[model samples]
Target: MLLLLLLQQLLLLLRLLLLMLLLLMLLLLLLLLLLQLLILLQQLLILLLLLLLPLLLILLLLVLQLLQLLQQLLLLLLLLSLLLLLMLLLLLLLLLLQLLLLQQLIILLLLLLMLLLLMLLLLLLLLQLLLLLLQLLILLLLLLLPLLLILLLLLLLLLLLLQLLLLLQQQLLPQLLVVLVLLLHCYCFYYYS
Candidate 1:
């Protein structure tokens, strides 16, 4: 009984340790998620810097054309700036789409991780159940041991009884043979007389 109690306490401690480890893993995953978000933010800042480049170039071009007082070049510069603006807009749109896709991917990855955690928890639960089943089997064997011993004793007693019956049969058969000879002798004497 004391040993059983110790085993149960040990199992409890093990369960607590596993739970703590799981919690630590979850914390680490959360930290990784935060780091990824920081990286994504840094990438966004870099993209924003890239987005400003065309506007700055267009401004510099306009300032140069104004300083030179060139009318024909001014019109060309305006058209060039308009084209750059349109390209910038398309680039921005594509970047936005890419960012949306990345966010979705990140969300999917997080969901997958959560599913993996759940699976791990289920596996732990199954392991605990298997341990409990093993304990129950051990207890059942302990319970059955005395009953098995009793059954064996009963079998031995039955074998002894069978032996005794065989001995009785052996003795009775000889006695019956002797009585038959005596009866035969009596019959012969009466016939002779």
Candidate 2:
């Protein structure tokens, strides 16, 4: 009985260890997911930086063209042309900035779509891991079934042996006594001769 109790405790401990391993695997998967998210965020930031380079170059060219045009203007038309040029430059800057914003929006939309796709892929991988865990659990159970059956058979055999001993005490004791008496008589007869 004590041995059986100890065996049950050992089985419980093994189950707890398996559960801990499962928890660790889940935590590792979460860490992997977080790392993937960080990587995606970094990629989108890089794409945004790359997209901004052309807009910066366009601004620099516009500034240089304005400087060259200013040097060619006369003092008489300077005041009038200065106001017109300022207005035109402001309008052009606003238009260019709007276009840049639109392009950024389109890039952001693309990034969002890519993020969605990545998330879907991650979800599929997680599902696959879960399925593998379930399969492992089923296999472990299958392996344990024969061991359980064997233990049950051993317990039944032990019970049968105990019952057989009880039967001997109750029904075979008198026959055993008669055999011992016969053996004792033969030994005495041989000793006398």
Candidate 3:
């Protein structure tokens, strides 16, 4: 009766040990799955960066083109202003030469009005340039938004991975210790018997 009871107890201990081993294996499998998920996330991040690279380059090119166009427009405006100033000086000379001629005065007035119109057109061009600059700023913001979102996602994943690792450590260490103690107890029991 004593031997039978001892044998039953030993069997129970063996079953407990097997259950602990199975639990450990399940935990390890879960860790593997988490690691795989982390790897997949990293790969996805790399792919996203790769996809964004071309778009970033295109945006940079567009911004460069816009800047170049703005510079050209500014040069044109400067040339136009210089031409208007030269025309004004020439008209003043003509006015002095034909002070008694009404036709000459009338033509000078028309030329002055045209210069004002040109100035207004320059202002409109400047406004258009401002609008283009605003559009470029908006495009830059749009581009940065996705990058920010991706960074946030990566940070979240890292935090989750850390938490998982900490939880695994907390849960696994004590369980491993228990398993080792049980194994030692079984070994001692067998030796003593």
Positional deviation of residue 165's Cα in model 2 after best superposition, in angstroms: 75
Looking at model 1, the pairs that clash are: none
Q: Write the per-residue lDDT of candidate 3 for residues 45-151, one digit (tens) a residue.
A: 78667766766776676677678667866876786787679678867866765776657666767678767867887787678678667766766776676677667
- Write the residue-wise lDDT of candidate 2 on 145-170 in tens digits: 55665576567556656765675576
Give, for candidate 2, the lowest lDDT window spanning 10 residues: 68-77
Which residue segments of model 3 deviate by more than 4 Å? 99-193
What shift in Å separates residue 186 of candidate 2 from its native position after superposition?
A: 74
Model 2 backbone overlap count? 0
Q: Per-residue alpha-carbon lDDT of model 1 for 68-94, expressed as tens digits?
A: 444534544565566567556655655
TM-score, structure 2 vs. true:
0.36
Model 3 alpha-carbon miss at residue 17, Å: 0.5
Where model 2 places Cα greater than 4 Å from the true spot, the runs are: 74-193
Ranking of all predicted structures according to TM-score, beginning with the best and ending with the worst: 3, 2, 1
Top candidate by lDDT? 3
